[model samples]
Target chain A: MKDEAMALRDTHVTLAHGGGGQAMRDLIDEVFAAVFQPPGMEDQARLAPGALAEAGARLALTTDAFVVTPLEFPGGDIGKLAVCGTVNDLAVGGARPLWLSAAFIIEEGTEVALLRRLVATMAEEARAAGVRIVTGDTKVVGRGAADGVFITTTGVGVIPAGREVSTGQVRPGDVVIVNGVLGDHGACILAARGDLMLSTDLVSDCAALGHLMEAVLAAAPGVRAARDATRGGIAAVLNEIAGVAGVGIEIDEAAVPLRDEVRGVCEILGLDPLYLANEGRLVLFVPEDEAGAALAAMRTLPEGAGAVVIGRAVAAHPGQVRMRTLFGGSRIVDMLVGEQLPRIC
Target chain B: MKDEAMALRDTHVTLAHGGGGQAMRDLIDEVFAAVFQPPGMEDQARLAPGALAEAGARLALTTDAFVVTPLEFPGGDIGKLAVCGTVNDLAVGGARPLWLSAAFIIEEGTEVALLRRLVATMAEEARAAGVRIVTGDTKVVGRGAADGVFITTTGVGVIPAGREVSTGQVRPGDVVIVNGVLGDHGACILAARGDLMLSTDLVSDCAALGHLMEAVLAAAPGVRAARDATRGGIAAVLNEIAGVAGVGIEIDEAAVPLRDEVRGVCEILGLDPLYLANEGRLVLFVPEDEAGAALAAMRTLPEGAGAVVIGRAVAAHPGQVRMRTLFGGSRIVDMLVGEQLPRIC
Candidate 1:
């Protein structure tokens, strides 16, 4: 029995743990199943489908991996970042997320306390998002294998019938609008690292987007496109739609919203604000005819109060995105090229 | 246009592609959208719901990142290895994988020919696996910023109803079985490096398992658990099943099969055969009553002529796995403590 216990301790990160073995079983029941479960997802112990169909009317699935540096950072840590990132992915994708699966690669000796806190935060975030954590995985690595923790989250959700929206439908003359601020996430992280100081109190704009999307999506079909400007800001998303729809995108830089603090930081950093990332913001492409209605709908929601039209899609320069300068010259807006401030997600 | 094209090539691994801008759009259309494109999928060119859904499902939804060292080794290069490795993951997971998303992080000046061969092999392997090379990403890094190239392949698949299975249900008293020899994958990888020339005949057991799994699934519902023994080998799998079912597992070491060459190599390497990885084989758990039938069904299949019962689940010592020696002493088996080899599959 003592030797058995030793084996248990020693046999750290094997395929069997992921295999649904005692390790896999305990990992799931003790760690994962506890945190990521959406509500009504009991009986996770059994192999049979659990409470999925009962309250499963709404569901969405989103998966992403986290490889941020300095595992622990201000405002949030990797664990919180991992869960919220996927939650937001689903939120902007327009689904009521119910369950999530977190797969982790842990460097050997990741402090148990840190893991515990991370797990606790995962649970907290899931609870905050009103979702359940039903399943997950843990993999141990050799020394020098990797640093700290790498988390991959796959979330599942259900979209209620009759709420169809997509980026492909974005048409020429569609007014591009954004909800609230931009670059706050990237700026806050930068400040948190002591790279800059915020004039106003600044915090990472890391938060779930379910309610915000729900608000805009509820107002119906005129909403042509929605995106969370994470790595490349609004310019990137608008360009994507234009390229996809074979149209040109023209953005009014003056009207493109940014928190003053964020603008100040970006200016000081010599970073283009359009290239900065945003976590707690939404970009919408709406038909010019429905632009007013969309803006009115956006302002009515707490999550969308600062909404404004920032661009339009044109028939010319199909698959191109451009920004009208404050000085009246237009410049091509492109996607981010590489790691712009790593871990800015 | 020239500037745009040059800009696209200038930045090796920009963050923009993920951002949805001109570069991101161009990458998607030129690199991804063009290559992938099987008959039914149209170039929607936008983030349409159907496009996302189709992209997610039409392929196998298998994502794996390659960080293997000695980038080019025996049997295959990292490029070939990454593509095949991911393809195998999809094949075994029961996906008629259609398209793939390849994201690469290449240390600066990786031989272009090596990458071309890798891409070619990816195409070849995709063709060989009856899949497609739809989307891809490339990022160049400063010298020493990375290994030659790290490839993450995200596969997609459409889950045919009534086909999804998990490792959470192997019952007590279920018989454990495996296909052919174990440790071939690890052995082959090691041998291919020429660190030890114990055997020049070592070939990787890397192959798709979908057809084999389909054949086995078609044969019996008594089959409770099925897993491809990859990283942590056969012992890891047995341990996982025992834990999941709240039962004990007893596998006869004598009955657990291994190749003579593999056994010889492990002895020289000071590694246990049971801990070594095998890419092509699957460990199956079936009820005792159906063991005979399952074996017969498996034997008739393409990947299974060498199938045999290696062990059985016991009610004793719940959540534990024990291996019986030829002389009758028992030893407990457990999950792998840490990664046996980093960057291996």
Candidate 2:
């Protein structure tokens, strides 16, 4: 308790905070140390004089910038999004997440109160993800540099040597699966914009997926690929796999899960749920024989309760993705030309 | 090569390009593989289906968002700046940067030509730094979702063992050194804003510090700490060390090196040169006994030619930073209230 108060009092982040000095120490010891441990990682202890300790884990690095308009959004804000976004990236890549470094771009007129809330939320999110927020950089743009706040988070994780998977490994006949419903992230952003007049008590599907992924990878050793369905939706994902593997994919649209409320909103907005964004959910591909096992494992995790086999890889129409509609028509599932939800992540 | 071209043609990046599929793979191979080389870092190699690689290297990760309006400035553009920004971070942290992941936010109406140029520049910069641009993502926002282009880059580096350094190590009488001139980056940004009627032909001193840092650390074995003089500039950095080490810093005004043009611009804008930013420079804290050797070693490097011993650590006023005026009057160097050049990164 004494340490917490001292940290907060002595080290709450300030602009000069990232300058790398006493303020940097207080920030690291008080704020970063209290949560995820990043004191020492490798050769850094030798090279980095002020580093806490050498992080013992093998490194997995991911960087993301948060520019969700409204600064504050339904279910989450830029701060929360920044931390979870990087956390999920590491998770899907099968990395045990570790330290994070953040940089903030603040507009000249940004409200101090809001910035405080954002930072606090960021700290909370980092702790929740079991990672430490270590070093940082901050810059103020003339009222035009950015909106209220744009946060970029870079994270390092440890990936065990044997656990390597890439989109290249996916093969024909692999059953494509989604952990849960999609479009929730994009829909919430649309709702937040309020210009859509779209009202349906919907919130974003943004949540961390580390634990959920751990469950699936543990249960199904045959999981060929994994990716969070954030931008470019499921269709985009299938096309990506097809293009990478020089294969084709066919989806049973009826089997793809969606919330009726979200569907209705998308219908009104002319938004293709296939192209809409999802924050919390992931799309997985596995051998046909292992699909069932993957599904059962996914169900065991709360975030993946809606797990379903939505598609399968095909040899025909190599490098293309297609879907069979409930109406009995088949059409090419194309990559979205533009963003369905801009600044969504 | 045939397979690569076909792969590139089949999977075009779209809103769902980041969706983790063939499209993602295609883009990764077509775009990224064309530029970077990582160990087993090719697009086709698969991560072990259920295996994870716990990072073997002591890791340092940094994320930065580029909102430098006008995008292109003298000496560099946003693309070049983006790559260098993240690289410098890892370099200053005493890490051998290994990989970089890039994410882009494109506002509606942004010219594809500009985006292409920026990307090419990014590739060029990465190559110059001898680092790989491994993973990437792109999103197009609605017209108002963002400005022209905002890039987020994340960098990962391996820090050697036994080189732990931090501001917490500041000791009374420790010598302070700077790699080169300060305020050039920020002033160049202001001059480019063009609205200032800023007539000087000064360009931003933006470049990767990894090489220069490599040289300094190779020779200055006793170097205590190092930091890039970036946002909030020199004062911000000094204050940070003071607060962290629980020591005071005293700077000799005449000893602080600055470009004549940069100084004039700061004076005209009523900006404090100390609060400006530097992209290609680093601040080194070394024990007094080794300060001369460190500065001498720095002078031998092209990037470090402007190295100067700016100040020394003092036991009194443990958390204050004092800068002696040219006339010999010492003034408290407080934290910068706001940025001098907004969004210059």
Candidate 3:
């Protein structure tokens, strides 16, 4: 069995590998099943976690599809991003992510070595996030019908009894805090694409935030809500909170953290850093009395070492978000209107 | 809000609709959220079904990616297939599907009307299958980077207490039963492609089997296992059961059910019906004593009106499947070797 498993001679994926025949079985056993180590070959994974049996605990589910260009990039690849993206989606909802299902659509003629690297990275990320890759499926499309590969990951988690986190939970006088530098991921992808003739030392801030979230919840049980600043960055998140909570948000422009490299990229590209995407950063809302505890808890983790107060929710001007400019003027920060960076995730 | 919701003026999808801004929100609200009616706008869906709290109950997870060409087909489109495929995966494992997460990878310039139709069909199918589409994501890639659209659905289900179904549970005396005529889906897809220049009245046998499976389980509590005969058809499923259970499966060629139209298409294309796909067919293994009850239960449902016994497990030639020819000769029915019908699902 070991010899046959190691004897996959195909250099590139083919239509036959997705035909539900011997070739597909060989590819799955040698590549994905080898790395993921699922519990069985059944069509579905059976899970009986203790968390689900707890009284009043709710199940949380989320999904994301990754279609980034230049499949591989500095700091992380599509595989790492897929895992972290879904994990953070659950974590921000106050759920403890437990299992994930990964489905891949691979174009014919994709290199098998590249797939192996992606699978390995996914396994590593799943391990770091303490989640299991329980079930998955693969499909192959004809050349030109699809890019090299697109991955969709679905995550399952358990929200503890009596725990609730939502955008609508934000209230007046709640302090807004963010973890780490913003726009590093967006700046890194722009430089990685190499289309604009730019170079930078910045890498994607794509890290799973489940552990950091758990730490914060433990330290400040009164945290109102949390949202990962992903596709539309912090600007989108703040606007969503304001609309959903029916409150006004005011942010101090200087208090928003930004790395020098990211700032330089935004300036050179004539872009606003506020709308650039980030993978690991999150905006958290807590009551004024617990804001210090939340910030202290976040700063204890390396991923959140730059945690700081970026803004606060106010009763005036409900359903609006405004930024207090460094030059002493304030302007409304509206939701993104159009595409600033495509496929940044 | 009502007028704004109906004012999706864009005829075709563009990068802006996936830019995590107002456009994306409008698209989601008008096209998806309006139909699926997810409970909240949070990153994840919070579910507290009573089934999860039951003692000994287990959660089931499965995922599948659909990339069939000609997005629309005679009997169903990719959207219906996505929902049915994931639901059947959970159903065949003795689980009652409850929720699904759908993620789409769409090419820029695809018609918005096409997307609306697909989402509507998905909503209809989910309603029929008794499952909720709780969360979803959409990404738009540059033109030519992807086909019309690819859907990946992840399903969550629950297994009742003490219910166990596995390929390894098929005993030597188990009887193999099929729910309906085989190969209709594969044959229909071939004719629908338009490249073959063949026309047929046959339609893809695509339907959700959750209710049928529940009925069967209720009728025959001792059934060993069940498998949806999808991509590589009954041939692949039989071979897998034989290998996993360490038992030989013997079938009578004349007893296997088939439609004349499907048989004609297979004959013209020099394809074997045994290796053709069926979206709504399943192979079940039940104890000889309970086969009658199981078949009778299946026959009560329209999806399984043609249920019949096609084969039986035996101790001889363990780990292999064989067919009895009409001329009194027998031959081994090995697993499929290569692609017969690509993207037939």
Q: Score residue B336 of candidate 1 by CA lDDT.
A: 59
Query: Could you give candidate 1's per-residue lDDT for residues B1-345 as a string of tens digits?
Result: 224554435334344444434454554454434444532221111122232233223212445555655566555666666666555565544444545455565555555446556666666667766655543444434454345566665554443444544556666778888888888877877776565655557777766565666676677655776767776777776665665667888889899888888888888878887878776778887778878877887788666888999988778888788889889899878765544554455
Worst 10 residues of 3 chain A by lDDT: A1-10
Error of 3 at A79 (Å): 0.7
Per prediction, fnat is 0.08, 0.19, 0.83
Model 2 C-alpha lDDT per residue in residues B111-146, reported as the tens digit of each score: 545666787888888988977776665554455546
Task: Judge candidate 2 at residue A142 and give its lDDT.
Answer: 53
lDDT of 3 by residue, A81-159 (tens): 9999999999999999999999999999999999999999999999999999999999988899898999999999999
Task: Report, for candidate 3, the interface RMSD.
Answer: 1.6
In terms of TM-score, which candidate is strongest? 3
Tell me the tens digit of each residue's lDDT in model 2 across A28-141. 454434343444421122223122232333446666767777788788888888888878888877776667777776665566557667778888878777777765655545
Q: Sorted by TM-score, highest first, which candidate order results? A: 3, 2, 1
lDDT of 3 at A338: 72
DockQ of candidate 3 is 0.75
What DockQ does each candidate score versus the true complex, computed on alpha carbons? 0.19, 0.25, 0.75
lDDT of 1 at A184: 74
How close to the true structure is residue A308 of candidate 1, measured as C-alpha lDDT? 83
Model 3 residue B213 CA deviation in Å: 0.8
- Candidate 3, TM-score vs. the true structure? 0.98
